[model samples]
Target: MHLVYHNLRRRLLKYTWFLKFLAFLLLVSTAIFLVFKIVPLLLKFPVQLVNFLKPPQSVLRTTSGRTNFILLGMGGAGHEAPDLTDTIIFASLNPQTQDIVLISIPRDLWIPSLRAKINTTYYYGEQKQLGGGLILTKASIEEVLGQPVHYGLAINFTGFTRAIDLVGGIDITIPQTFDDFKYPIPGQEAAIPEANRYEHVHFDAGPQHLDGATALKYVRSRNAEGDQGTDFARQARQQQVLTAFKDKLFSTQTLLNPNRLLDLKQTFSAALIHDLSDAEILALVKTAFFNPPNLRSGILDTATSSGLLTHPPVSARYDYQWTLIPQDDHQLKDYVRQLLFGQ
Candidate 1:
């Protein structure tokens, strides 16, 4: 009977050892599976979360590390030839140097192919298609500059005023007091008395705050005496207002207020046209924040001795239209290069 009890104990010990070995094999198999398969699944959420937290970039279209935009400003409804873009600015941004150059393209510059002034290109294009105006404008500008244009933007005079007002107006320092005796009154172009069609507008010298209507008059006044009467002066004033408006728009007070942003968004939606995506715009904002731009400006003018362009003699070939043309077509490209690159 004692021998029988010893044999049973030995058998029980062997069975217990076999069960322990099976348990060890199970643990080993599970660890191998987790390392090869289940671990990736567990890590996926964290990887995805990290990606989600990353800031967005690489949205803007660029050429040779530079981004170019064509900006157009038009007289909105209730003005004669309202679709005509009077202000054409070529805005180029160099990301590495944070240099922004604004080159003003003369509105009265003649385009032989179109048989019209460059400013009228936008109008004719819009008559052809819905967004063709900007496309044509970009193409024309590219042709003149001999470079690629990445995008186009357009805003009308009405939107300009509303935008200025929304930002509580902007301050401009007039270099000299000027008067525009022939400033055309809106909706009075066909008034019976030709003299009554225009209203005299004046501005005092020194720094002053301008509301919407007053700012509009300030920028649109073209018949001021002496140097102020020239288109170059007009372009300078436009650029000045643009700079002031930009400063006001990006100020801390404007940024922190949600209501102001919403209003400005609505105003822009109503008045502005562009081909930029939200991501692209956000990228621009990000770039500006990280690298503030050094602003520069140039105007293509007909300054008798020191200008890139000159006025052609009166001819029926151009419908006797007063227009400016580059003195040397070959020199235009070089001039634009210098204006943009300082090279």
Candidate 2:
């Protein structure tokens, strides 16, 4: 028995150096994960992409229900039509029922009040430096939807690319094969004459593993052929990419990977614009854990049966360009309410 004990102690002593090395490695990995992952907490709460940030308001109740958000996406500064609101949508969440819906608003929507595209409301606001566009967008959308929005999140094109890359990339289904012959080439390859900057990009039909650049092109390409050439097609693609990326971000693989989670958390904190306080953010985390929301989505555009119609400019009405007009604003609002609230 004494001989057996001595042998065991000798073996442990012989492996002590390796055991200490493993312990040291574990310590380093943990520290790295915490530092990078907890950056959002360390830097300060609610990282703002825009400057018009104010105290967060409570989740609003509509005649239909409570908790709605407006999400706007744009080209930001470096892309063409830097101010164009490339994507506009509303997200409504019911913490109690764990139901969430995303409703896309067409970028071509014409606002008679502004005499410009609804998407342009963001552009005009930013061009005028009206607190960087969030306030103006929220007010205009609330007027249109007849519902109050409690929060707003706007992500630019650059942000999208960065986020997709940070998550290590995303997988998507290309509904059909298509090509864009005019995708603007950037960097030093930028054409001296804007017209000469076009490049052809082809996306094959079916499932694809897309990196940030490929994903951006998939969603943003409008100068393609057949059905792929339409804004409605682009909207659908955007939603597909959005859904895929959301799943990737929330997937077990991403969630379980400490490094990816850390990068994504820090990346999105810098990329997204919102007024959610730390407590609100924590509550959201809790809600998500306790009751995961079922995501439902819809598109509002020229393609939908109850969608907007192309309105020719009328000089008398101060309409000056091509825009999509809702036949009846009140009716549209009611439809949206039913779609979002089912009430």
Candidate 3:
């Protein structure tokens, strides 16, 4: 009877050991799965295209502090083409204070140094290969503002359209009816095709829904009413679109879907070029969404506009110009500081 009891106890001990071994195997499998299988798949949709494009060591830097950056949008003449920056916006963010400020610089603003269009900074940068167009544009903006542009992101218009489409289009309220006679179609030449172009955009001056293509037209149409008949109006429209898109992104439905997040990353990846790392972008997004401050929109006054003149030696045909920036640097700085630090 004693032998029987001992044998039963030994059997129970063996079973316990077996169960422990099985649990260890399961844990090992899970670790392997995450390390070898799941991790690689997850990394495929990285939000760090800028990092991939320009490694940290290659990027140029100036003195670092809480400052602003310019987000330039270069609308190419055709698909995949690299053109001068058609849209330039200065954006400032303070990580500690969570302040945000955006200021749009008109593309046609005259810069005297270049003796060409304000957008010609891209051309100069590309010619010198300093940092492509973005570097030269940053320098020009810094010269204008009397403040350094810490970094910039230059995206092609095609990619911009794709990003809007990925977000399922942006809803914009048109304040007036307008005709965009020269809206260029993608894959076409610099000149707008007469047959393909829509001469009149007849949206009433009220809240209206717009798709990616229509939104592009809406912002690009300067001849429309209340458009200032200049690039300044275009800038305002662009900001409106950006604000609407941001609102949509923060919506509960879009934020909850992993698939939608991945789609957004992919969509922007094709268009965006920035100096920020994936980690930095994630941190910025968190701050921007959680405790966003009021976003003020303005442009350089008319007094700042320098007249257009042809650039010597580069090209007699192409004209360039420079515009005066705000006279008070402290005002600009203080405004940015308040936005970044204040509630």
RMSD of each: 27.1, 17.9, 21.4
- Whole-model Cα lDDT per candidate? 0.68, 0.61, 0.53
Residue range 175-210, candidate 1, lDDT tens digits: 988989999987898988899899999899899999
Candidate 3 achieves a global lDDT of 0.53
On lDDT, the candidate that comes out on top is 1
Error of 3 at 141 (Å): 2.1
| Residue 84 displacement in candidate 1 (angstroms) | 0.5
Determine which window of 10 residues in candidate 1 has minimal summed lDDT. Answer: 1-10
Q: Write the per-residue lDDT of candidate 2 for residues 1-343, one digit (tens) a residue.
A: 0000011112222221112221222222233334454345645645421111322123233334457777777666667777677777766777667677666666766666777777887777777775557777877778777777777766666766776786678888888999998887654245677767888999999989999888888876879999999876876787677767767766777667877766655655555566554445544544444555676654443443433344556565645566666666666666666766676
Cα displacement (angstroms), candidate 3, residue 18, comes to 64
Q: Which candidate is the best by TM-score?
A: 1
Candidate 1 clashes between residue pairs 3 or more apart in a chain or in different chains: none
lDDT of 1 at 319: 83
RMSD of 3: 21.4
Clashing pairs in 2: none
- What is the TM-score ranking, best to worst? 1, 2, 3
TM-score of each: 0.73, 0.70, 0.60
